[model samples]
Target chain A: MSQIVCDSSSIISLSENCLLNLLPRFKVDFVVPRSVEKELVDKPLRVDEFEFKALRLREAINEGIIQVKDVPGVHKRAEQILAEANSLFTPRIKILHEGEAECMAMLELTDVNTLLVDERTTRLIIEDIIALGNFIQSRASFKLRMDREKAMALQERFSDVTVLRSTELIAVAYEKGLLNNLGDGHLLHASLYALKYSGCAITKGEIKEYLQLLK
Target chain B: MKKEFVEKLKKAFLHGDARGLKEISNESAEQAVLSRDKEMVLISLVSYALYKMLTKPHYHYAPGWSDFVKEVVSHLELCIKDPRAIQEALGKRLIEDIAKMDKLHGRFMGDLIERARVKQASRAYAMGLSLDSAAELTGADRFRLYAYIGRTRIHEEIPARSVRDRYERAKEVLG
Candidate 1:
């Protein structure tokens, strides 16, 4: 069985797209780590606009659709390194978050082989080494700094993991006969784009490709 | 893009009119659907909205609330040409300039950038940009933006039952 742990980004994408209620439809168990729970619930609830989503997330937790787990200790062990890697990216584009780190840790402790993450920084660091280096090189070139060592360190530290965006999940649900209700074959395209605008990081080409593949 | 509106907005900022600032925020929020809050106009609008929330009259000042507001308005004097850049610079300055204070005053100025991001996240999401696209525009992490979007979704009436129905329809069309 395939298992996945979610960072808040994927959760938010699902929520914003009106797809949170459909998590059980997926073949995978959508696990939410503790820190992510706080970001989605505790902190945002303080603001008026975020209150509703937080409450809904709270309800999801109650129903066991979005399972909130206490982060394992390995998450803490990974913290120093994750923080180091996070610092490597400039503040303007830093990708490390406690919730994301916790998801990564869950990967180590469980059979979870993939992490559903939405942020580019962590994804690039783990999955796309060259792009990550180019990002550093481009930024470093601007500052006249050699970023090879730093970039290499970040890559080596987190280079083994696979990252998936919330968009792919939407695609999966679509392929599974779950999203057919969105209205004909058009919903696939519409929902994919919806996730994009609503905050899923998949690109237009990817959406096009997925739609074509499904066809 | 409306010069008159910008001027009125500037005046509202100068006066620390929380209500007026909020009105500006609301008006800008509506623009997301039209794709009108281009190049950070939406971002600036959010900053003002955050300002309104942080400085509400009923909330007693912790200590540096007034100073934070003053400092934010002070930057209005320079470089309004790019409202987004000005807001970003103001946010950076506020974080740098906010003095030590009790939690009551809140780090009104220090959180300018973050609050702006939060607001930007909301605006970008509201504008029909996906989480990825919206996150890209605002430079906010997806999770953080999701939190923002989650809150906004509370009032939104999403047709939750449509995905399966739509998929079935698409299959027939494709077939």
Candidate 2:
């Protein structure tokens, strides 16, 4: 089966919306790196508000629905990506974290080319770094600086990668009749919005379009 | 941060100047976004929390309010002297103090701090950092941040890739 490396953002969104069942329903393998597992389960298990969500993720792990793979040499690759990606902008604020880096490392080191991430930055970094820079510049009151060569290099590195949000996954599930039991007419609409509110980096306009296409 | 900014922050906290604290918080938040400095983000969050405490009638009149204010002011003084050395300590101590105060007074000061974090994180998001980056820097929950961000015009301002194209790609990849 084709594997999709899962990031904590997508898993959290899925777990928050009680969509873990969709993992097994898909024909592909749903894999997460060890660091993402820590974010999803280990660290969150100690916090009261997130304990139940952690438990739900842990249960999915126990059931073999979600596989946690500790990719060897992942740390080195992650650090390299971190250094490269973080340095792409001047004044060098870290744009990526360990967990997200690990997911990317796993993708690079393994056969996985598709990353299931709900966060906007990582997707933007891979799919459209220039647009990402534009978005960041638009929000910044001060003049934003970018190293064009580094941006191009980083973008070239991950050009083959496919990024998908939980919203897209839900839309796929809707198309495949996986979400039918939830009721027909409004299932896709409600699920998409739930994923959005739950932290999927999808716009309201996109959700409306999905509703129009799928409905 | 500049010495003047630190001094102004110290003065604001010393006098319980809620408006000044609010303004400083906004300034700090903007700097946090520009510099990507975690300390600036913490300062913004702490300043906002202090502002809320001083402004809320119930919190202002609470018995331990003066004590809490004094503790925060002392931390700010240390920040003025050595911000790099004191920022982390101030953040930890502020949380500990708020937790203690909440327990002692049956107040929601800890929740206030959390709200301040989410609000500051949203501000960071609005200022141009990605939502995840903002939440990661400010220690805000992504779920809460997204909920807060959805209420704003941030998403509408950015041009996103076509949903149809992305959805098609997702289907092909998964299949």
Candidate 3:
């Protein structure tokens, strides 16, 4: 019964795969900032799979499956950054700038056990903060047990007892037809990236080779 | 590389001349799409111009088209003679333009800056907008924030530096 407070990236990624359906199975009460909700739902939906997720996210909110928590003081900070940012750089970076801050804040406020984010810089900053020995109990990405479970479920032959690598898991996902036309590859890629940062011995070559067969 | 080319770009951008832009666009796209050197320099130049244009409307609008063009042409000419001059000029221009925009926009701008500043100062604040703005303004890599939290668990093992240094003789190790 872990209370999972997800950043926009996790929600967007999960929803895109229509994997928000998986939340109830985990029985994790998920919280997202109102800013994240607005970001996903406020704008007109685009033609991409991302837009599909946005609509689904809105539906999840309506059903009360996912709770929205808006961080106060975020708006004021966003406004300040936007004004200066536009005067300095392109607006394309605007959402990301705020999303990163919001993600960190949400983790702090919820005291959540784990954080789920895909951005490299955000991941790096979290690692830096952790290196400073500030908070005592927080994790990022999938827990080792969770990764093992996912790998097991992904393939019968993956041998759950053996330490199957991310590349092997990806290959299994490919063989099982789970990666076909699915946007979740990005999630897999994010996980792999995080694993690499964590010093996993998994080679990307195997993953790429497996990915070639996915389509 | 040519004085005329620089003059043309200066005139086009200062005037917001769609036609002059059309010409510049065609040439650059050709260079970008076909050039052997990959036209990295030209890409940088175009990026500089676009960055300036999007960020500083007031400055672009201030001198009217012609005077701005003359100023830009002179700047480019200086840059051609000494490349470092362009880097310095670009930095100077950006700071000046940003400062002026900040001054002219006043409270409207003030509010945004304040918002971004608050997010920077407080770990509790979590607005996507504010964080995005702060990162852009501060030029800090935003992703580092996530990694910071993930790595900060107090109970975790001493980091790679100490552990690795004990095993490897030559690796760089932090105390």
Clash pairs, model 2 backbone: none
Ten residues in sequence with the least summed lDDT for candidate 3 chain B: B166-175
Put down candidate 1 lDDT per residue, A33-63, tens digits, no spaces: 7877887788768766568878888888888
The candidate, 1 or 3, that scores higher on TM-score is 1
- Shift of residue A181 alpha carbon in model 2, Å: 1.0
Q: Write the per-residue lDDT of candidate 2 for residues A62-145, one digit (tens) a residue.
A: 998899988899999999998887787676666778788888899889878999987778888889888888777766667768
Instruction: Indicate the fraction of true inter-chain contacts that candidate 2 also forms.
Output: 0.49
Candidates ranked by TM-score: 2, 1, 3
DockQ of each: 0.07, 0.54, 0.09
True contacts kept of each: 0.03, 0.49, 0.14
Residue A55 displacement in candidate 2 (angstroms)? 1.0
TM-score of chain A of each: 0.86, 0.97, 0.49
lDDT of 2: 0.79
Docking class of 2: medium
lDDT of 3 at A56: 74
User: Candidate 3, residues A1-215: lDDT per residue as tens digits?
Assistant: 55555555455444543455545533346666776666667642543423655677788988876788776675665455333322321112232355545544555444453444433323323333233112111221111111223222322321211112223333334344455556654655654445433322233453343344343
